[model samples]
Target chain A: MKIAVDAMGGDFAPLEIVLGSIEAIRENPHMEVVLVGDEQQIFTILKENNEQKNPRITVHHASEVIGMDEHPAQALRKKKDASVVVATALVKDKQCDAVIAPGSTGAAVAAALFGLGRIKGIDRPTIATPIPTVNGVTVMLDSGANANSKPKHLVQGALMGSEYAKLLLGKANPTVGLLSIGEEASKGNEVVLATYPFLKKLKTISFYGNVEGRDIPKGTVDVVVCDGFVGNVVLKFAEGLVTAVTQLVKDGIMAGGIFAKLGALLVKPAIKKIGKRLDHTENGGAPLLGVNGVFIICHGSSKAKEIKTAINIAGDLVDRKIIEHIQKTIEVEGAFKYEYDE
Target chain B: MKIAVDAMGGDFAPLEIVLGSIEAIRENPHMEVVLVGDEQQIFTILKENNEQKNPRITVHHASEVIGMDEHPAQALRKKKDASVVVATALVKDKQCDAVIAPGSTGAAVAAALFGLGRIKGIDRPTIATPIPTVNGVTVMLDSGANANSKPKHLVQGALMGSEYAKLLLGKANPTVGLLSIGEEASKGNEVVLATYPFLKKLKTISFYGNVEGRDIPKGTVDVVVCDGFVGNVVLKFAEGLVTAVTQLVKDGIMAGGIFAKLGALLVKPAIKKIGKRLDHTENGGAPLLGVNGVFIICHGSSKAKEIKTAINIAGDLVDRKIIEHIQKTIEVEGAFKYEYDE
Candidate 1:
């Protein structure tokens, strides 16, 4: 299998992206990587790592780079030769089985929608993010692909998220839950209320009645489906909270005098382990599902290890034929036929 | 001043509620408490605590008690003498300066609306919850009051929340932010997009444009305003994540053998401090804003300490005349006059 990496995407672009691609290829000798960015820059980093002449590693030249602050669709339209767009195009042309873009999430989503297009019968593509839960991980969809979504779009997200869980988390029959404020079927906003009945009538996924925000981290359901707006807010809020809590702990230890400093040193390893367990990087990147091809979106600040894991995950998704399964599920279930939304 | 307490509300009813009310009156010698619940139950618990003869504490007989699982509005209509309803009615009848119900949030909200009524020019009453941030606290509003909110309601919420921060948080010119998926003005769903312009045009509040979910924890703004559905989900999700993360740290230590166990014992105090700082109980109950009377809603699982703090908060709100301030702001600013929505 071959993968295309958007070398100029993230904050530590070209350098970290090149290192991760090299590391992924080194670990999995059966696969190859195509680093899409400035040729000279990619080669310079490759030379520093002494893998400049490696047969498995290749560099595809792309002059333009989409900034982290750029408007997604407009940037993609203007910068035709942008690294992220070029990398996605490689997958579109079938030069690679999958593509990894570790830059602005908006840019990646835009490139996926523009380059690979949407799957048959899927109205919106979702960014399915794997959140760390107590028991294991829970996959939440539409984490920030589309700002606004219809009830049918959420139904499509549920099916796609379920399949992703089955392939990625190794769940035989993953339970899907609609994200809402309360557990009752009648308890959410207008969109959630409209989506609930349709989810219950679905045959493809095991539908859990309704799950609240607390249910996500408790591992109450394998797949959590919501519109992009709420999902994005939850994801970012969790991230900010974890960081703030960690800082609070550190400050507490600092204020505790000599005994506290000694204790913090002793428990540093245990605390580090806890941080690793809750870290988003441990799960690699979120997948931009519903796109015709495999596209993984990583955090802009992701280092080499996270990118490597994302590449491996992309390979697994490609081998598992996730898109095929999703397409079949949508067709067989006739998800859009429910027409519960008057 | 006299405050009415719903003695039969919370999980550890009558016992914790009566004890908390006793503690509050003991601390504030100037105030009195009316424990509204079953007369026999309240007296028995008070006698057990050796406070039955206390002159400052009185029992107001209420026959019905709304269960946590009961439908809020429906139960309030049927159970006229419910503890929460009677407690709220005391405030409405001007027999008590404020009311504190540490029971079902829905029931508390229902009782507040049904008994106290909405302040003029306010379409919906919001639950303004104080969340602990790294620096101090950030007050988030509409935290599960109105599941569906109109754009005008949000504008009213911002004005009310701003007044809440000024009186409760002690901020002179509290900045209000409309919670959305992104920080940009044009970044949210239909309601948020429509609310943004109104917030910006308001002279009463120090509008801070749009803030993301992470901003709540980061203390980016004094007031984080959103529709109740999204606000409730975010609140519950944060609670779950904090618990899950704490458990993860414990599990990590346990799984690391003898050294980890020894380190855990040493760092226990530092960890305990962090937990205490993040504990929502420390902040007491949420205030049901935009209501004509002072009504505070506590957690269903609140203990004596939490209830006591909530009683104190109720006193603070009543003393500050929060309802009057909110009403004044709404009328003076003519918040509904913006007419941004088509």
Candidate 2:
């Protein structure tokens, strides 16, 4: 299977992306990679590391790269040769099996939506994220993808989240929940209350009623659904907490006395493993589901490790045939549009 | 001032409450205390400590108490002579300056609503809490007091939150923010949208459009307002995160050897201090503002340290006359209310 990487997409861009691509190719001998960006920069990084380019990992040069602050839709239209767009088009055209980018989240989303298109019955594609909880990872959908969502959009989130969970996490019947202020059927704002009965009536997944903010960390539900705003907040808060905490502990050990230093040495590996598990930086990025094809997104600040993870995830998604599985199993009906004045 | 203490409330009640009360009265020489609970249990704890009960700290015993899991309204009616009911009555009858209970939150809300009554113009009382952030403390209101609040309730929350920020935190014009998924004016659920325009027109506080979840810890706004459910979720999530991180850090330190142990000490003080500040336990109890009088609701898990802090908070609220301030300020612009089906 072939994977297209947006080499100029993230903060570390060509350097980290190239290194990760080489590493992923090294890890998975069966996989081939297409690094899309300025050819010279990509080649320079490969040469600097004394790595040889092969048929398994090739460079697909694109002249332009989208800036983080640029309007995603506008940039895609104007900069047709932009690395993210070109990479996505390669996937759409079957030049590659899946597309991967750690660039502007907005640009990546727009590129996938415009190039690869939306999945049938999926009004809006969602970024499905598996959040870490005590029990395991509970899936939350639309993590900073679409800011505003309708009741229909929310329902689509549940369906997409369910499909993603069943296919990726291997949950036979994932329990889908609508993120709300409370569990009561009559509770929450109009949107959550309206979405409850539909979710209750659905036969797709094990529709658990509504889940609150605190429930997310407890890993209460298998799949938690909300608009991108709440999802982003929940995701970032969890990420920040994990990051802040790991740093705190590291700082403690570095500064403590002889005994505390000894204590720190006793369990560094186990703690690092736990830290790795929680870091979104290494989670192979968030996948923008509901698109016509598989598309994985890493954070903009991601380095080599995260890029490699995303590449691995893309290959895994292709191997799992997640897109086909979602299309066949989950059926989203009567999708309504939320026409914001924006 | 006479403060009614729910001696039977909290996880470590009577024992912890007794200990905390002794500390409170000892610290505040002018204050009198009223211990309200089962006479036997109260007396046993007081006698064991022999330090809490002075001429200024008296016990107003009750025969029954409300247990967790029982419906608040039902419990209030059945246990009219319950500790919480009796404690609230002290405030209602002006026998005590305020009623402080580190008990079942639902029970406390029920008692306050039934006994002291909602202040005129305030449709729903807010459990306004001052959260310690990296920047400072941010006063967030409607912290799960009423789950399904309308647009008006958010406004009420803002008013109460603002008043508290000014009166307690000493901010002249507390920057009040409507908690949404984004900082944009057009972000969030329908309720947030409806409340946004109204907040812009608000005259009381310096309204800073909207803020996302991550900003709460950054102390972007002095006062943050949202419906009960969102507020509750935010409050609980923050508390859970702080606790979870602290546990992880402790676990991390315990895992290490001498080298790591030595390092752990470097940041232990700062980490501990941060944890303590983030501890909702150290922040005292949430004040049920917009009630007829000062009513403080400590966490059900309150220990001696928390109780002492809560009592100190109660004394401050009484001295500050927060109720009268809320009434005089927000009472003029009748808070919005939803006509629910239930």
Candidate 3:
């Protein structure tokens, strides 16, 4: 149940990652944490804090890091000993059950693919993230994993997204939705129209038909599927909007006066909780589903808390055998089709 | 200038419509309002309020009204003297500078097309709405006037949008951005990709390349051109988001104690102004662009303030001869193409 964490992955790499890993190690003594990064840098960070006493947490040093701007494939090829790559390798070698990185998304994906390989029949890996909705959270797949995709790619996304939703959200045959400009199957551009039929034909999940952007926050469906391009826009807009709004709300509350301070005091906890939920920086990690191994990607700017959450998510996902469940579900689908044919 | 008002449109028709009309009459002295609706209902509403003192604002009675659920084309065909249809006729017959409605968007477009006709070279009439952006307001066209469109429709939308921008926002050659998933000409769905090259070939305005969804509020480009379906989604999302956020901000503010009430009082004026500016409700109304006459369609829930603004917009559009300008711009493209072909 050990997790290999890329300590040098995120914007607040060594310090936040170290602190978060220590938190995890403190919480779970049975599981070990392999903190991958430059040894001296991590040690120095621990020394500055004067709280590096954790038997379960060990520093597994890697001298390299994947820069955010570097091309993902090139970086993976060049930086073989990069923290993300090394961490992924640890997962492949069975040294760790799962790997976590809040670093470069592309780099992490490339390393995971190169190290552990893609799941059979999975042509593309998807980054599935839970979007807040009134009905709970809608798990939207390929949030930005691969921007351009064909109709088949979208079907793959739908399948992968369904598995993730069922595993993570504990849904009974998660209601799946195809994200489109309109709800009607006849609507949307060609890609959507084509994908609609494919998704409808798949019997692994309860295909709830098409959903629009407004349907996301409303929690109209458990699993919303789309190509990376539209999914990316919707996800990014939600991120940017929630961020912009949270700031404005905070600003509105703190608008200079004795009354504002008093008012803030009364609603501070509720506001803080809402802020935490909306903070993609905190809920920054996403499972790169469709890959064979358990891989969780955090935001580039993830801090200590988020990195720890990614690790926790990776642990839970591995424990639940999400990828295996996905395989079994696909197998069941094949069986269903074969039996029908017979 | 005399404006023809749809007195029988919207959810709170004849009431809010009449009240908004009164507000508009009070605000603009030089302008006259012709309220077109059910004679009995109009008289009853006005008499109940006892606001029939003004000679400038007169009621042109009609019994027919278009319901929101009815098909736009069907309603337009069946009810020739419906408020929306008659209002459009007012503009067509030169009885009024423009027509305003807070009713069904489809019926407004249908009736406008039936009565006012299309501007030269503009094959189909499109609904153009001014979205308040970070930079300023951007006039986006085909905001769901026609669902399915050709590449030529997009080009025409661009020309009409550009003309509206220049005339409404007073931007000298406002940069026209093709709304796509990405900035690259090739990076888009079918409709967008097919439209890009055609738009690039046109020279009526400054074509600033493709713009993405998240770029809408970021204030990158001035004119965003898209098909009806996509535009509808964008418009609705923007409307929903702004409404949700501003309400959240206000709710956060009002959560304070007694002192918070005082704090609210301090910034109430400024906050009100912000709300007013961001409020699309008071932006007069969406103009059914590409129509030959100065035809305006107000929101479904328009109040007196919005009605006044719609009338003013009509006067300005008519005074500036916006339709003639659009016609000439299209003619310029046509002449160039004709010469090149020869």
Query: Candidates 2 and 3: which is better by lDDT?
Result: 2
Q: Rate the local accuracy (lDDT) of all candidates.
A: 0.90, 0.79, 0.76
Which run of 10 residues does model 1 chain B get worst, by summed lDDT? Answer: B333-342
lDDT of 1 by residue, B193-255 (tens): 988877888888899999998899999999999999889999999989988877887888888
For A1-342, candidate 1 gives per-residue lDDT tens digits of 999999998899988889989899899988899999999999999999999998998899999999988888889889999999999999999999999999899889889998999999898899999998999889999899876778899999999999999998898899999999888887888889999888888889999979999999999999999889889999999989987887888888888877778877877788788788788888889999999999999999988888999999999999999999999999988986767564
B1-342: candidate 3 lDDT, tens digit per residue: 888989988888888888877777777778788999987788787777776767887889776999977877878788877888887777788888888878888788888887878877777888888876554677777777876666778888888888888988888888899877556675666667777777778878889999877666665778888777667756665565555444444555567455545555655543454466557876788788888888788777777777768877877897888888888999988722421211
lDDT, candidate 2, B1-342, per-residue tens? 888999888788878887788788888888888889877777787788775446977878898888765677888888879898999999898899988888788889989998989988887888888877656788888887876677888887888888888877887898999887666675577778888887777677799988877677667889888777667766666665555545565665567655456656654564565566567778888889888988899988888888888888888888887888787667555444333223
After superposing candidate 1 on the true structure, give the runs of residues whose Cα lies further than 4 Å from its correct spot.
A340-342, B340-342
* Cα DockQ of the candidate 3 complex: 0.22
Residues A1-342, candidate 2: write the lDDT tens digits. 999999998788878889888899889889999999999999888888776547787888899999876777888889989999899999988899998888788889999999988877777888988777655778888787776676777887887788788766787898887888657675576667777776776666688898877777777889999878667766765654555545555565566566556655555664676676567765778899989888998888878888888888888888988888777655443333323222
Best by lDDT: 1
The reply for model 2, stretches above 4 Å from the true place, is: A37-53, A58-65, A71-82, A146-156, A170-215, A218-222, A243-271, A331-342, B51-53, B61-64, B73-82, B148-152, B184-204, B207-209, B242-274, B328-342
Per-candidate clashes come to 0, 39, 2
- By summed lDDT, which 10 consecutive residues of candidate 2 chain A come out lowest? A333-342
Chain B TM-scores of the candidates: 0.98, 0.94, 0.90
